[model samples]
Target: MTQTILYARVSTSEQDLSHQRTQAEKAGFVIDKVVADHGVSGVSTRLAERTEGKRLFDMLRRGDTLVVRWVDRLGRNYDDVTDTIRTFINRGVIIRTVINDMTFDGATKDPVQKAVRDALIAFMAATAQAQAEAVKEAQRAGIEANKGDVTKYRGKKPSYSRDQFQTVIDLLSNGAGASAIAKETGLTRQTILRIRDDQPAAETALVKWGM
Candidate 1:
């Protein structure tokens, strides 16, 4: 029995996965598993730390079918997205999209059709990145609207625990770089970098909380 798997992600937990769910269901996918990365930015093309992204590897098999709202769901950028799709296709997995009903399959007799499919995948991956940028722009607008309002906290909790973050620092201090740390921990290099470069205040919180 071939199972169809649905993968989805939203940059913020506040953003609903319902839309992707609805689309996949409407497109006739049974959705054996829903792997999602909430509050994950699509601008990141690496399949590094996306909770669902990693799950996709374990859940997928040669015969299983993969469905997504779009290619962007797999990646935040074009090259990564294309590489991923091609790898899946090479592995004998079928990739399908709800929008445009785009399909990329490796089982084709004609060389021309294969070329066309490859080109389409490349184009769609770029489109996915463009749409992700749009999503981020919209989120920025919403954040700006509530700027300086301090009355409300409108964001999802961090997936990494404070202890885990400090552990990241400790590991770094112990001579671990981003790549090494990511391998040591389950987190992505980008996530570690984000903690290091963007969130210095988080370090104080870690110390104050005894993490």
Candidate 2:
């Protein structure tokens, strides 16, 4: 009745899937199944909107447990984050985060216990939102700082092949939208558009750097 299901997410396709997978594995979870959402920015609080997110609803069950590397993986918005966790609780699912070793459940019958549980959920959700906002603000500042000068190097390496780039182009040329390409190729829309714009330099960088 109690088992672990893994969830991993990345803001961009260039991020390596193996990294998250390793984290979950190292945390002592064999990962009976994995739900991965790619190219969905953490700044967005709607976990359900992520491509692989909906799959979680289908794969997880009442008695099963949900596992993530961190609480932020559940959501970025405070209300929605708390609601999502509590929803799973109502359905008899236990939510566990590897980073903090936290657990949330709906097994208590006492009112005070319920109040404590809800309070904890609210606090975790608010902290997740604050963390998300902080990351977003930092990214915006970095972009603004680099807006006038293309002098510094971005630590992230690009990832894509010429053939891969052409695939995106062809998909677009055939009238496929960004979302469609993302679903089909497991590449993010931002990645697809970059290829569509014919950035040969970017394409090469994608190959050389493996974004």
Best by TM-score: 2
Candidate 2 per-residue lDDT over residues 1-211, each given as its tens digit = 5567889886667666665666567657677778888778666637887788867776778889898766778876887788788878888898887664678888889999999988987887787787566545655565576675543324356555434554464456457798898787677888877766644445334433335
- How much is the lDDT of residue 174 in candidate 2? 56
RMSD in angstroms, all models? Answer: 16.1, 13.4
Q: Which parts of model 1 have CA positions greater than 4 angstroms off?
A: 133-211
- lDDT scores of the candidates, listed in order: 0.70, 0.69
Tens digits of per-residue lDDT, candidate 1, 1-211, equal: 7788888776556656766776567657778877777777667636656766887777788878888876777776888899889888888899987765678878896999988988888888887677556545655664577687533324444556644664575566455699888887688888888876645444333322323
TM-score of each: 0.62, 0.68
RMSD of 2: 13.4
